[model samples]
Target chain A: MSTRELKHAGLNLQQTDPKTHEEAESRVFGFWVFLMSDAVLFALLFATYGVMLSGTAGGPGTQNVYEMKSAFIETLLLLSSSFTFGMASLAMKYEGKASRISVWLAVTLILGLGFLGMEMHDFVKMIGEGATPERSGFLSSFFALVSTHGLHVLGGSIWIVVMLVQLSVFGVTPAVKTRILRLGLFWHFLDIIWVGIFTIVYLQGLTP
Target chain B: MNQEDRAEYRRELRSYIIGLIAALVLTAASFATVHWRLFSAPTGILIAIYLLALVQIIAHFRYFLHIDLRKSARDDLQLILFSTMIVLLMVGGTLIVLFNLKSRMF
Candidate 1:
């Protein structure tokens, strides 16, 4: 690969030859592959959920533990945050405004934290009501599926913070810019998974 | 990226927001339908509602997530479709097999 190719691959997209786009393209391509791999992990968890769905041992089934109103509110927050994050990415990459991107990122981060806060409260309430993960196999799967998502959101929240700090220090450097792009993908991808969780794990659990 | 493109992008964002709200409402209605027994229906109707909500979820992905097949990386959609098929088989097949086995063997 020429210096031009290496540059687009996160070396210097702003100044390099446009034909050297494979590096930037490859970064996204690699991320898509990673997303598919993640789908496999989710598939496994989903299967596990299906298999153990009836193993509730008559102890507070999904309907008993799941709170639709709270979940609805949580869904609203995350979905809106995903939208805002998309706007931040647009501002950063397309609009090329450092401060505008930062503002959007801040909003996204606060919404994410709010979702996490509410989820934590839900979990505490579940356990307090004796529906802890150890209560049954189904509970175990439920906690696994939902908390895995919660942890991912928490990680994404940290990532956004770091990116903001980098933005202030580096001022939209290509590296930071590329990272924000990937993070946008990551954030939105989590919201997509939450759509599944809210439907299958939360809603179906409430079903007879 | 310019004034017109920015306007177009905002339009898309607004649509995404609208779809997101619809998905949320549909999901909530589905949940409440089952929990409070909001209507007179059997499991079949509930299952249909569930399927409808799932469609809305896919809608969210299409409009909000923007995961079109064209933008997918090489073989990503192929693998997802294949894996989804396998997931369907494993989940559905097991439900049938185990229920049958539970009845006969037990």
Candidate 2:
């Protein structure tokens, strides 16, 4: 396939080695299937959240618990990390330098970690403010949706560490390259979901 | 690779950067709508926020995930469209049913 065609198909064209291109293409396509299904899961959670938005049970409402500044910072961190991961993929494909890829990956990892840290602090602050999930239905769904996304970010972070190790030990093999491309898709997909969360859950909550 | 291939790679990289900028701006707008109360009515603000989010989602899908309606991506696009349909049905149904039940109980 031409580079443009490959990109259109959502497959990275950086790994142009004829031998493994076919396998990588199928693998990435399969991963996309998984991601679409995952989207359904998040959609369901979001729906549940919408249903429970008013179920405060006399507990603290969204305005009392949500911190807009923290949420905004988290958004910036995750979005920037997505951009950095794209750079990592670019380094892997265009530069074809394992060291350069590793550098970008490390930067992405730090940004991911920063996002998680801020999220954890936000959760702690909420709990400290008596906004525990068990305190009300609204809080329950809030925790469920946001925590599920957090778990996904945690999983992606672990995968990044493992991939970094793989890169060092195995170098930029076809297998590693394909894995990085898939990770990039997964990371970007999570950011898309976060946009929904911050807009629907946080921004709407703070709107008055 | 040839010079043409190199140029294509550069173009792809630039697209990703552009996507990053667009996403950031959308996020900022979402925050601004809430913080500044750009709209006097709460419902108006809500509608604006949702519209902004929908656009940002499409931006991410096209620029970051590279899923588009081009010939090569037709299958993937079909799958996404189908999944979106199911999600809307399920989620919309849940809201209607549950909200109706709550109203009846009250």
Best by DockQ: 2
Model 2 bad stretches (over 4 Å): A7-19
Please write out the lDDT profile of model 1 over residues B1-106, one tens digit for every residue. Answer: 5675566557656666776667667766666676677656657546756676677666665665554455333254565567667767766776678677767976
Clashing pairs in 1: none
Best by TM-score: 2
**What local lDDT score does residue B71 receive in model 2, on the 0 to 100 scale?**
80
Best by lDDT: 2
Q: For every model in order, what is the iRMS?
A: 5.6, 1.6
**Kept native contacts, fraction for each prediction:** 0.33, 0.83
Candidate 1: chain B TM-score against the reference chain B: 0.73
Clashes of 1: 0
Name the weakest run of 10 consecutive residues (lDDT summed) in model 1 chain A: A3-12
lDDT per residue, candidate 2, A94-124, as tens digits?
6677899999999999999999999999999
